[model samples]
Target: MKWTPQDIETYLNAKEYVDTAVVPLLAVSVGGEMKQSAAGAEFITLLSGHLERQFTGRLLLLPPFTYLKSNYGENTIRDLREWEANLAKEECKHIFYLTSELDWRTQEGGLIGTVIWLPSIPLEHMNDSQKMAVVDSQVKQLLELFTQKWHENQ
Candidate 1:
């Protein structure tokens, strides 16, 4: 399910079965590196969409949790924790934060939910078929990780 009115309606009807939330962590920059930041967000968004499709009934795809690249620090982690708390209160058993920013990897230990950091794959030059092929391959690997996490918690 996605974070849309229609999807939320379906999700409410099957809330218990959809115990997971997938959030894409996006870092925005308005400097010279802005293009790189946008590319990372694009790649992550595509990957998250593909991932959600693979587990539509089991996961809720939330909007990107965006933060300024220059403001990524203790405050950012604290805000992300608040998101986790709210989701947990709503009975979400699993929360996954997917990102292409390497900074997230260093802060994973301080976070309660899983933080998956993948190096950004430049997709601007890829054709539709090529893009699908790359996203599919990444999602396949992610599927294993998700299932493993589910089993561990069970």
Candidate 2:
């Protein structure tokens, strides 16, 4: 389910069947790399929305977890772990963090959730059809990975 009031209500009613939580990890920056950060955010947000639609009732797609690009390290891990802990208490068996920031890969060991890193694709230049095609392709690839993870855990 997407993070909307109506979806939350639906989730609350059928929370038992939704065992997974998907979070988009976004990096914000106002410095020289501002454009890149924004691009990543846009890509991940669109991709995540598409992903959530694919499995609306099976997982909850939380809002993007934003952190400054300049501030990443132990603090980031700590904050994300806090989120994981809370989700676990809510009965989320699988927590997936999706991002376009490659730096997060290094900190995966400290996280209980799975971290998926995909390079950012500039969507600003693409037309609606093009953007949909690109996002669709990425979701297709991710569908296999998500299913594999679910099966392994089961």
Candidate 3:
């Protein structure tokens, strides 16, 4: 479904509903230390905290699923698809995928993140800041959207 700003407004207004936002970040290292890197941990912690604040009593943060191998196999895709489907069934209103490309040989590894707002917020209207927020703290943005929608509905 196309997500319009009004839809975001509507979802935010609802009294009680399950809403979820996903952020997928990719990292690579020569020694598989990226998972334990300070930067990685800090980024995840920041995003988690932000979401928690936004959702307050209604947020559920899923554990981070990291991929160390780069085969990009069919099974990998299937697993991701299944994850998305499960979130959908849980009545998730937002889903964000944050990705980063790593080139160990070139030492050019960095973050490239994207936020996917599902079934509710329209993709077209999202600004750069909003998209970045998805990587940083998408839950807060979702909560903002929810709050806006709630007020409008009333």
Candidate 4:
């Protein structure tokens, strides 16, 4: 389910079946490279929306967690873990953090959830059809991950 008032109501009632929450971790550059960060955010938004649609009945797609790349570090780890922990209170068994930021993968932090990092695609330069093609391939990977998680639970 996408994050919405109506969806939240359904989720509250059917939390038993909805066992996963998907969050997009986004970082914006505050120094001098705004264009690259904008492209990254667009890629993440498209990919995340597609993921939510594919798993609509099972997962909740939360808003993007935006932070300045210039200010990322130990505190970033804290914020991510804390966010995951708080989401656990919603009774979600799995939390998936999706992103195209390659830098986040190298950061050392406790894992409260699984992080799926895809290479950043330049969506702004691509035509809609081309963008959809990229999204399609990525969706397959995401579905496989979700399937693996579900089977493990059983």
Top-scoring candidate (lDDT): 1
The lDDT values for all models are 0.95, 0.94, 0.46, 0.85
Quote the lDDT for 28 in model 2.
95
Clashes of each: 0, 0, 9, 0
Write candidate 4's Cα lDDT for 11-68 as tens digits. 8888898888888989898547788888888888999999998988889999998888
Candidate 1 wrong stretches, greater than 4 Å: none
Q: Write the per-residue lDDT of candidate 2 for residues 9-113, one digit (tens) a residue.
A: 999999999999999999999979999999999999999999999998999999999999889878988898999999999989999999999899998887888
Give the alpha carbon lDDT tens digit for every residue of 1-154 in model 3: 1134654455456525635444444443445554444344445545555655556435344555455445444565456667777766656655545333332222212211123222222223567577456544555555666566445545
What TM-score would candidate 2 get against the native?
A: 0.98
Worst 10 residues of 4 by lDDT: 103-112
Instruction: Provide the global lDDT of candidate 2 against the true structure.
Output: 0.94
lDDT of 2 at 25: 100
Alpha carbon lDDT at 28, candidate 1 = 98
Is candidate 2 or 4 superior in lDDT?
2
Candidate 1 C-alpha lDDT tens digits along 26-145: 999998989999999999999999999999999999999999999999999999999999999999999999999999999888877899999999999999999999999999999999
